[model samples]
Target: MKILVVDDDPGIRELVRITLQDAGYAVAAAAEAIGALSMLEAENPDLAIVDVMMPGMDGFALTRELKSFKDMPVLLLTAKGALEDKERGFRAGSDDYVVKPFEPKELLFRVEAILRRYGKEEEAPILAGPLEIDRQSYEVTCGSRTLLLPLKEFELLTILASRPNVVFERERLLELVWGLDYEGDGGTLSVHIKRIRGRLEGLTDRVSIVTVRGVGYKMEILP
Candidate 1:
Protein backbone atom coordinates (compact mmCIF):
# COMPACT_ATOMS: atom_id res chain seq x y z
CA MET A 1 0.00 0.00 0.00
CA LYS A 2 1.14 3.55 -0.66
CA ILE A 3 0.95 6.33 1.98
CA LEU A 4 1.75 10.03 1.90
CA VAL A 5 3.34 11.28 5.13
CA VAL A 6 3.26 15.08 5.58
CA ASP A 7 5.09 16.80 8.42
CA ASP A 8 7.23 19.92 8.48
CA ASP A 9 9.63 18.47 11.04
CA PRO A 10 12.39 16.69 9.14
CA GLY A 11 13.13 14.38 12.04
CA ILE A 12 9.49 13.41 12.39
CA ARG A 13 9.19 12.92 8.64
CA GLU A 14 12.25 10.68 8.52
CA LEU A 15 11.10 8.68 11.52
CA VAL A 16 7.66 8.07 10.04
CA ARG A 17 9.13 7.23 6.66
CA ILE A 18 11.51 4.66 8.13
CA THR A 19 8.84 3.11 10.29
CA LEU A 20 6.22 2.86 7.55
CA GLN A 21 8.77 1.76 4.95
CA ASP A 22 9.95 -1.02 7.27
CA ALA A 23 6.36 -2.18 7.47
CA GLY A 24 6.32 -2.74 3.65
CA TYR A 25 4.47 0.40 2.53
CA ALA A 26 5.60 2.73 -0.25
CA VAL A 27 6.14 6.01 1.58
CA ALA A 28 6.13 9.53 0.12
CA ALA A 29 7.31 12.23 2.47
CA ALA A 30 6.35 15.92 2.18
CA ALA A 31 7.20 18.94 4.36
CA GLU A 32 4.30 21.18 3.41
CA ALA A 33 0.74 21.11 2.13
CA ILE A 34 1.74 22.25 -1.36
CA GLY A 35 4.32 19.50 -1.56
CA ALA A 36 1.78 17.01 -0.31
CA LEU A 37 -0.71 18.15 -2.96
CA SER A 38 1.93 17.79 -5.66
CA MET A 39 2.81 14.31 -4.44
CA LEU A 40 -0.87 13.38 -4.38
CA GLU A 41 -1.26 14.43 -8.02
CA ALA A 42 1.91 12.57 -9.02
CA GLU A 43 1.04 9.44 -7.07
CA ASN A 44 -2.47 8.88 -5.84
CA PRO A 45 -1.79 7.26 -2.49
CA ASP A 46 -4.11 4.81 -0.76
CA LEU A 47 -4.03 6.96 2.39
CA ALA A 48 -2.48 10.11 3.83
CA ILE A 49 -0.96 10.79 7.30
CA VAL A 50 -0.72 14.50 8.08
CA ASP A 51 0.48 16.55 11.07
CA VAL A 52 -1.92 19.25 12.29
CA MET A 53 0.66 21.98 12.81
CA MET A 54 2.57 23.17 9.76
CA PRO A 55 3.99 26.49 8.64
CA GLY A 56 1.33 27.11 5.96
CA MET A 57 -1.87 25.27 5.04
CA ASP A 58 -2.05 23.10 8.14
CA GLY A 59 -3.33 19.56 8.07
CA PHE A 60 -6.95 20.60 8.75
CA ALA A 61 -7.06 22.86 5.70
CA LEU A 62 -5.32 20.22 3.63
CA THR A 63 -7.88 17.64 4.69
CA ARG A 64 -10.72 19.95 3.59
CA GLU A 65 -9.06 20.30 0.21
CA LEU A 66 -8.55 16.56 -0.10
CA LYS A 67 -12.23 15.83 0.49
CA SER A 68 -13.20 18.09 -2.41
CA PHE A 69 -11.91 15.52 -4.89
CA LYS A 70 -13.44 12.39 -3.35
CA ASP A 71 -13.64 10.39 -0.17
CA MET A 72 -9.96 9.93 0.57
CA PRO A 73 -8.93 8.61 3.99
CA VAL A 74 -6.84 11.09 5.94
CA LEU A 75 -5.34 10.39 9.38
CA LEU A 76 -4.29 13.24 11.65
CA LEU A 77 -1.08 12.84 13.65
CA THR A 78 -0.91 15.77 16.01
CA ALA A 79 -0.13 16.93 19.56
CA LYS A 80 -3.54 18.62 19.85
CA GLY A 81 -5.62 16.48 22.16
CA ALA A 82 -8.51 18.72 23.09
CA LEU A 83 -12.00 17.57 22.15
CA GLU A 84 -12.35 20.69 20.01
CA ASP A 85 -9.21 19.89 18.06
CA LYS A 86 -10.37 16.35 17.52
CA GLU A 87 -13.77 17.59 16.38
CA ARG A 88 -12.05 20.06 14.07
CA GLY A 89 -10.06 17.24 12.57
CA PHE A 90 -13.22 15.27 11.89
CA ARG A 91 -14.92 18.39 10.54
CA ALA A 92 -11.94 18.82 8.24
CA GLY A 93 -12.54 15.35 6.75
CA SER A 94 -10.15 13.19 8.76
CA ASP A 95 -10.91 9.49 8.84
CA ASP A 96 -8.91 8.99 12.04
CA TYR A 97 -7.14 11.08 14.66
CA VAL A 98 -4.07 10.12 16.68
CA VAL A 99 -2.68 12.33 19.40
CA LYS A 100 1.03 13.02 19.68
CA PRO A 101 3.46 11.24 22.07
CA PHE A 102 1.66 8.15 20.91
CA GLU A 103 2.99 4.63 20.84
CA PRO A 104 4.02 3.36 17.45
CA LYS A 105 1.85 0.33 17.98
CA GLU A 106 -1.15 2.57 18.67
CA LEU A 107 -0.50 4.51 15.49
CA LEU A 108 -0.25 1.29 13.56
CA PHE A 109 -3.51 0.05 15.01
CA ARG A 110 -5.40 3.30 14.23
CA VAL A 111 -4.14 3.29 10.66
CA GLU A 112 -5.23 -0.29 10.19
CA ALA A 113 -8.64 0.45 11.68
CA ILE A 114 -9.21 3.43 9.36
CA LEU A 115 -8.19 1.42 6.32
CA ARG A 116 -10.38 -1.47 7.34
CA ARG A 117 -13.34 0.82 7.96
CA TYR A 118 -13.03 2.21 4.45
CA GLY A 119 -12.50 -1.23 2.94
CA LYS A 120 -15.66 -2.71 4.49
CA GLU A 121 -17.74 0.45 4.39
CA GLU A 122 -21.21 -0.01 2.87
CA GLU A 123 -23.09 2.41 0.67
CA ALA A 124 -26.35 3.77 2.04
CA PRO A 125 -29.54 2.82 0.29
CA ILE A 126 -31.48 5.22 -1.88
CA LEU A 127 -34.16 4.97 0.88
CA ALA A 128 -37.20 5.35 -1.31
CA GLY A 129 -35.12 7.60 -3.58
CA PRO A 130 -34.58 10.45 -1.11
CA LEU A 131 -31.62 9.49 1.07
CA GLU A 132 -28.22 8.67 -0.44
CA ILE A 133 -25.05 7.53 1.24
CA ASP A 134 -21.48 7.67 0.00
CA ARG A 135 -19.87 5.04 2.21
CA GLN A 136 -16.32 6.18 1.63
CA SER A 137 -17.18 9.72 2.66
CA TYR A 138 -19.57 8.75 5.50
CA GLU A 139 -21.91 11.37 4.14
CA VAL A 140 -25.69 11.13 4.21
CA THR A 141 -27.38 13.20 1.57
CA CYS A 142 -31.05 14.02 1.96
CA GLY A 143 -32.43 16.00 -0.91
CA SER A 144 -30.09 18.97 -1.28
CA ARG A 145 -28.75 18.82 2.29
CA THR A 146 -25.69 16.71 2.98
CA LEU A 147 -25.05 15.79 6.63
CA LEU A 148 -21.73 14.60 8.00
CA LEU A 149 -22.10 12.13 10.82
CA PRO A 150 -19.87 11.35 13.75
CA LEU A 151 -18.01 8.06 13.61
CA LYS A 152 -20.44 5.98 15.65
CA GLU A 153 -23.53 7.57 14.10
CA PHE A 154 -22.08 7.01 10.66
CA GLU A 155 -21.51 3.34 11.45
CA LEU A 156 -24.99 2.96 12.87
CA LEU A 157 -26.68 4.54 9.86
CA THR A 158 -24.60 2.42 7.53
CA ILE A 159 -25.77 -0.77 9.21
CA LEU A 160 -29.47 0.05 9.19
CA ALA A 161 -29.56 1.73 5.80
CA SER A 162 -27.61 -1.09 4.19
CA ARG A 163 -30.34 -3.59 4.98
CA PRO A 164 -33.69 -1.92 4.55
CA ASN A 165 -36.90 -3.80 5.49
CA VAL A 166 -34.91 -6.35 7.49
CA VAL A 167 -35.61 -6.56 11.20
CA PHE A 168 -32.29 -6.51 13.04
CA GLU A 169 -32.80 -7.91 16.53
CA ARG A 170 -31.85 -5.82 19.53
CA GLU A 171 -29.10 -8.24 20.50
CA ARG A 172 -27.77 -8.12 16.98
CA LEU A 173 -27.93 -4.35 16.91
CA LEU A 174 -26.12 -4.11 20.23
CA GLU A 175 -23.34 -6.39 19.15
CA LEU A 176 -23.02 -4.83 15.73
CA VAL A 177 -23.70 -1.19 16.56
CA TRP A 178 -22.30 -0.95 20.07
CA GLY A 179 -19.53 -3.51 19.51
CA LEU A 180 -19.33 -7.04 20.89
CA ASP A 181 -17.69 -6.03 24.15
CA TYR A 182 -20.07 -3.21 24.97
CA GLU A 183 -21.50 -3.56 28.48
CA GLY A 184 -24.56 -1.38 27.96
CA ASP A 185 -27.97 -2.91 27.69
CA GLY A 186 -30.46 -2.59 24.83
CA GLY A 187 -31.12 0.97 26.00
CA THR A 188 -27.86 2.06 24.45
CA LEU A 189 -28.99 1.07 21.01
CA SER A 190 -32.31 2.75 21.68
CA VAL A 191 -30.53 6.04 22.30
CA HIS A 192 -28.83 5.87 18.96
CA ILE A 193 -32.06 4.84 17.32
CA LYS A 194 -33.81 7.80 18.88
CA ARG A 195 -31.10 10.12 17.66
CA ILE A 196 -31.34 8.76 14.14
CA ARG A 197 -35.07 8.95 14.23
CA GLY A 198 -34.91 12.52 15.41
CA ARG A 199 -32.70 13.45 12.51
CA LEU A 200 -35.10 11.82 10.08
CA GLU A 201 -38.15 13.30 11.81
CA GLY A 202 -39.48 14.98 8.72
CA LEU A 203 -39.16 11.77 6.76
CA THR A 204 -40.40 9.59 9.63
CA ASP A 205 -43.82 9.45 8.07
CA ARG A 206 -42.27 8.26 4.81
CA VAL A 207 -38.85 6.64 5.29
CA SER A 208 -39.32 5.49 8.86
CA ILE A 209 -37.58 3.12 11.22
CA VAL A 210 -40.05 0.68 12.67
CA THR A 211 -39.84 -1.03 16.05
CA VAL A 212 -40.50 -4.71 15.45
CA ARG A 213 -43.03 -5.21 18.29
CA GLY A 214 -41.18 -7.55 20.65
CA VAL A 215 -38.05 -8.00 18.56
CA GLY A 216 -35.96 -4.91 17.64
CA TYR A 217 -36.02 -2.43 14.80
CA LYS A 218 -36.26 -2.38 11.04
CA MET A 219 -35.90 0.53 8.68
CA GLU A 220 -39.38 0.51 7.20
CA ILE A 221 -39.73 1.19 3.50
CA LEU A 222 -42.61 3.56 3.18
CA PRO A 223 -45.37 2.67 0.78
Candidate 2:
Protein backbone atom coordinates (compact mmCIF):
# COMPACT_ATOMS: atom_id res chain seq x y z
CA MET A 1 0.00 0.00 0.00
CA LYS A 2 1.07 3.61 -0.65
CA ILE A 3 0.40 6.61 1.60
CA LEU A 4 0.80 10.35 1.02
CA VAL A 5 1.61 12.48 4.08
CA VAL A 6 0.63 16.14 3.69
CA ASP A 7 1.84 18.52 6.40
CA ASP A 8 3.54 21.89 6.37
CA ASP A 9 5.74 20.92 9.30
CA PRO A 10 8.72 18.91 8.16
CA GLY A 11 8.94 17.16 11.51
CA ILE A 12 5.34 15.87 11.50
CA ARG A 13 5.58 14.91 7.83
CA GLU A 14 8.80 12.98 8.33
CA LEU A 15 7.40 11.27 11.43
CA VAL A 16 4.41 10.01 9.42
CA ARG A 17 6.70 8.85 6.62
CA ILE A 18 8.82 6.83 9.03
CA THR A 19 5.86 5.37 10.85
CA LEU A 20 4.02 4.23 7.76
CA GLN A 21 7.20 2.98 6.06
CA ASP A 22 8.12 0.92 9.12
CA ALA A 23 4.62 -0.54 8.96
CA GLY A 24 5.43 -1.83 5.42
CA TYR A 25 3.90 0.86 3.24
CA ALA A 26 5.35 3.13 0.57
CA VAL A 27 5.33 6.78 1.65
CA ALA A 28 5.34 10.12 -0.14
CA ALA A 29 5.45 13.46 1.66
CA ALA A 30 4.42 16.91 0.39
CA ALA A 31 4.65 20.32 2.08
CA GLU A 32 1.12 21.57 1.53
CA ALA A 33 -2.08 21.18 -0.44
CA ILE A 34 -0.74 22.49 -3.75
CA GLY A 35 2.23 20.15 -3.71
CA ALA A 36 -0.06 17.29 -2.71
CA LEU A 37 -2.32 17.91 -5.70
CA SER A 38 0.70 17.94 -8.02
CA MET A 39 1.88 14.63 -6.58
CA LEU A 40 -1.58 13.15 -7.14
CA GLU A 41 -1.31 13.88 -10.87
CA ALA A 42 1.80 11.72 -11.13
CA GLU A 43 1.11 8.91 -8.63
CA ASN A 44 -1.92 7.57 -6.81
CA PRO A 45 -1.68 6.79 -3.12
CA ASP A 46 -3.95 4.28 -1.43
CA LEU A 47 -4.53 6.70 1.47
CA ALA A 48 -3.63 10.26 2.41
CA ILE A 49 -2.72 11.67 5.85
CA VAL A 50 -3.62 15.36 5.94
CA ASP A 51 -2.91 17.85 8.67
CA VAL A 52 -5.41 20.48 9.70
CA MET A 53 -4.59 24.21 10.05
CA MET A 54 -2.25 24.68 7.08
CA PRO A 55 -1.29 28.13 5.77
CA GLY A 56 -3.62 28.45 2.75
CA MET A 57 -5.87 25.42 2.24
CA ASP A 58 -6.59 23.52 5.46
CA GLY A 59 -6.99 19.76 5.79
CA PHE A 60 -10.75 19.98 5.48
CA ALA A 61 -10.53 21.83 2.16
CA LEU A 62 -7.84 19.49 0.85
CA THR A 63 -9.79 16.40 1.82
CA ARG A 64 -12.88 17.74 0.05
CA GLU A 65 -10.95 18.37 -3.17
CA LEU A 66 -9.22 14.99 -3.15
CA LYS A 67 -12.43 13.07 -2.52
CA SER A 68 -14.09 14.90 -5.42
CA PHE A 69 -11.91 13.00 -7.87
CA LYS A 70 -10.81 9.85 -6.05
CA ASP A 71 -12.69 7.18 -4.13
CA MET A 72 -9.93 6.57 -1.59
CA PRO A 73 -9.89 7.52 2.10
CA VAL A 74 -8.50 10.67 3.70
CA LEU A 75 -7.39 10.80 7.35
CA LEU A 76 -7.18 14.07 9.24
CA LEU A 77 -4.53 14.87 11.87
CA THR A 78 -4.92 17.92 14.02
CA ALA A 79 -4.28 19.35 17.49
CA LYS A 80 -7.97 19.89 18.10
CA GLY A 81 -9.75 17.05 19.85
CA ALA A 82 -13.17 18.60 20.41
CA LEU A 83 -16.30 16.92 19.13
CA GLU A 84 -16.99 19.79 16.73
CA ASP A 85 -13.58 19.39 15.19
CA LYS A 86 -14.21 15.69 14.56
CA GLU A 87 -17.62 16.47 13.11
CA ARG A 88 -16.08 19.03 10.77
CA GLY A 89 -13.58 16.47 9.56
CA PHE A 90 -16.35 14.01 8.80
CA ARG A 91 -18.31 16.71 6.99
CA ALA A 92 -15.29 17.35 4.80
CA GLY A 93 -15.10 13.66 3.83
CA SER A 94 -12.45 12.43 6.20
CA ASP A 95 -12.63 8.72 6.90
CA ASP A 96 -10.82 8.94 10.23
CA TYR A 97 -9.35 11.50 12.63
CA VAL A 98 -6.08 11.38 14.54
CA VAL A 99 -5.09 14.01 17.03
CA LYS A 100 -1.70 15.67 17.07
CA PRO A 101 0.91 13.84 19.17
CA PHE A 102 -0.89 10.63 18.35
CA GLU A 103 0.32 7.22 19.48
CA PRO A 104 1.99 5.56 16.49
CA LYS A 105 0.28 2.23 17.18
CA GLU A 106 -3.18 3.81 17.28
CA LEU A 107 -2.58 5.60 14.00
CA LEU A 108 -1.53 2.37 12.37
CA PHE A 109 -4.63 0.58 13.62
CA ARG A 110 -6.96 3.26 12.31
CA VAL A 111 -5.25 3.23 8.94
CA GLU A 112 -5.64 -0.51 8.70
CA ALA A 113 -9.31 -0.31 9.63
CA ILE A 114 -10.04 2.29 6.96
CA LEU A 115 -8.24 0.25 4.32
CA ARG A 116 -10.08 -2.92 5.31
CA ARG A 117 -13.43 -1.22 4.80
CA TYR A 118 -12.60 -0.17 1.25
CA GLY A 119 -10.91 -3.46 0.36
CA LYS A 120 -14.24 -5.25 0.52
CA GLU A 121 -15.81 -2.65 -1.78
CA GLU A 122 -13.03 -3.05 -4.34
CA GLU A 123 -13.98 -6.69 -4.92
CA ALA A 124 -17.67 -5.94 -5.45
CA PRO A 125 -19.28 -5.62 -8.81
CA ILE A 126 -17.97 -3.08 -11.31
CA LEU A 127 -20.54 -1.14 -13.30
CA ALA A 128 -20.19 0.62 -16.65
CA GLY A 129 -23.18 1.88 -18.57
CA PRO A 130 -25.65 -0.99 -18.67
CA LEU A 131 -23.08 -3.71 -17.91
CA GLU A 132 -22.17 -5.05 -14.47
CA ILE A 133 -19.79 -7.79 -13.38
CA ASP A 134 -19.53 -9.16 -9.86
CA ARG A 135 -16.47 -11.29 -9.35
CA GLN A 136 -17.45 -12.45 -5.88
CA SER A 137 -20.84 -13.78 -6.96
CA TYR A 138 -19.58 -14.71 -10.42
CA GLU A 139 -22.50 -12.94 -12.02
CA VAL A 140 -22.88 -10.67 -15.02
CA THR A 141 -25.88 -8.43 -15.57
CA CYS A 142 -26.95 -6.16 -18.38
CA GLY A 143 -29.78 -3.85 -17.47
CA SER A 144 -32.50 -6.11 -16.05
CA ARG A 145 -31.15 -9.22 -17.78
CA THR A 146 -28.57 -11.57 -16.30
CA LEU A 147 -26.05 -13.25 -18.60
CA LEU A 148 -24.87 -16.82 -18.28
CA LEU A 149 -21.54 -17.07 -20.13
CA PRO A 150 -18.95 -19.79 -20.22
CA LEU A 151 -15.83 -19.39 -18.14
CA LYS A 152 -13.65 -17.99 -20.90
CA GLU A 153 -16.36 -15.81 -22.36
CA PHE A 154 -17.18 -14.34 -18.95
CA GLU A 155 -13.55 -13.64 -18.23
CA LEU A 156 -13.15 -11.96 -21.60
CA LEU A 157 -16.18 -9.77 -21.03
CA THR A 158 -15.08 -8.77 -17.53
CA ILE A 159 -11.60 -7.88 -18.81
CA LEU A 160 -12.97 -5.52 -21.43
CA ALA A 161 -15.67 -3.97 -19.29
CA SER A 162 -13.21 -3.30 -16.49
CA ARG A 163 -11.71 -0.63 -18.70
CA PRO A 164 -14.48 0.47 -21.01
CA ASN A 165 -13.56 2.21 -24.26
CA VAL A 166 -9.87 1.39 -23.84
CA VAL A 167 -8.90 -0.61 -26.93
CA PHE A 168 -7.08 -3.82 -26.04
CA GLU A 169 -5.02 -5.63 -28.65
CA ARG A 170 -5.42 -9.33 -29.41
CA GLU A 171 -2.09 -10.31 -27.84
CA ARG A 172 -2.78 -8.30 -24.68
CA LEU A 173 -6.27 -9.70 -24.20
CA LEU A 174 -5.06 -13.24 -24.82
CA GLU A 175 -2.28 -12.81 -22.30
CA LEU A 176 -4.66 -11.48 -19.66
CA VAL A 177 -7.76 -13.63 -20.28
CA TRP A 178 -5.88 -16.81 -21.14
CA GLY A 179 -2.58 -17.24 -19.36
CA LEU A 180 0.59 -16.84 -21.43
CA ASP A 181 1.28 -20.56 -20.90
CA TYR A 182 -1.98 -21.53 -22.58
CA GLU A 183 -1.43 -22.88 -26.09
CA GLY A 184 -4.27 -21.42 -28.13
CA ASP A 185 -4.44 -19.67 -31.48
CA GLY A 186 -5.85 -16.12 -31.82
CA GLY A 187 -8.86 -17.67 -33.65
CA THR A 188 -10.02 -18.91 -30.26
CA LEU A 189 -10.26 -15.32 -29.14
CA SER A 190 -12.52 -14.42 -32.06
CA VAL A 191 -14.81 -17.32 -31.29
CA HIS A 192 -15.20 -16.23 -27.65
CA ILE A 193 -15.88 -12.66 -28.70
CA LYS A 194 -18.65 -13.83 -31.00
CA ARG A 195 -20.23 -15.86 -28.23
CA ILE A 196 -20.11 -12.95 -25.82
CA ARG A 197 -21.71 -10.67 -28.39
CA GLY A 198 -24.49 -13.18 -28.95
CA ARG A 199 -25.23 -13.22 -25.21
CA LEU A 200 -25.32 -9.40 -25.11
CA GLU A 201 -27.57 -9.04 -28.12
CA GLY A 202 -30.85 -7.17 -27.37
CA LEU A 203 -29.95 -7.04 -23.67
CA THR A 204 -29.04 -3.37 -23.78
CA ASP A 205 -28.33 -0.84 -26.49
CA ARG A 206 -26.08 1.25 -24.27
CA VAL A 207 -23.17 -1.19 -24.32
CA SER A 208 -21.41 -3.30 -26.99
CA ILE A 209 -18.09 -4.96 -27.59
CA VAL A 210 -16.53 -3.17 -30.55
CA THR A 211 -13.92 -4.96 -32.68
CA VAL A 212 -10.93 -2.85 -33.69
CA ARG A 213 -10.46 -4.75 -36.97
CA GLY A 214 -6.76 -5.59 -37.13
CA VAL A 215 -6.48 -4.82 -33.42
CA GLY A 216 -8.56 -6.58 -30.70
CA TYR A 217 -11.70 -5.40 -28.93
CA LYS A 218 -12.96 -2.88 -26.39
CA MET A 219 -16.19 -2.69 -24.42
CA GLU A 220 -17.76 0.53 -25.65
CA ILE A 221 -20.48 2.37 -23.74
CA LEU A 222 -22.65 4.50 -25.96
CA PRO A 223 -23.97 7.83 -24.75
* lDDT of every model, 2 decimals: 0.76, 0.82
Residues 1-223 of candidate 2: C-alpha lDDT, one tens digit per residue:
7888999999988777865754446898898998998899677888999999898999999999889868669999998999999999999999999998776656876887898888822455778787788765778887677877788887788778777888878986776566546588999999999888888775877788999989989988888
TM-score per candidate, chains pooled:
0.53, 0.54
Query: Clashing residue pairs in candidate 2, if any?
Result: none
Q: Which candidate ranks first by lDDT, i.e. highest?
A: 2
lDDT of 1 by residue, 1-223 (tens): 7888999989878767755653346788899999888877778887889999999899999999777755778999998899999999999999999887655545655776887887832233434347786756777777787778777776667666766777777876665545446787777778888888888775445667789988988776666
**Cα-lDDT of candidate 2:** 0.82
Worst 10 residues of 1 by lDDT: 120-129
Identify the leading candidate in terms of TM-score.
2
Clash counts per candidate, in order, are 0, 0
Q: RMSD (Cα, Å) of candidate 1?
A: 13.3
Q: Worst lDDT window (10 residues) for model 2?
A: 119-128
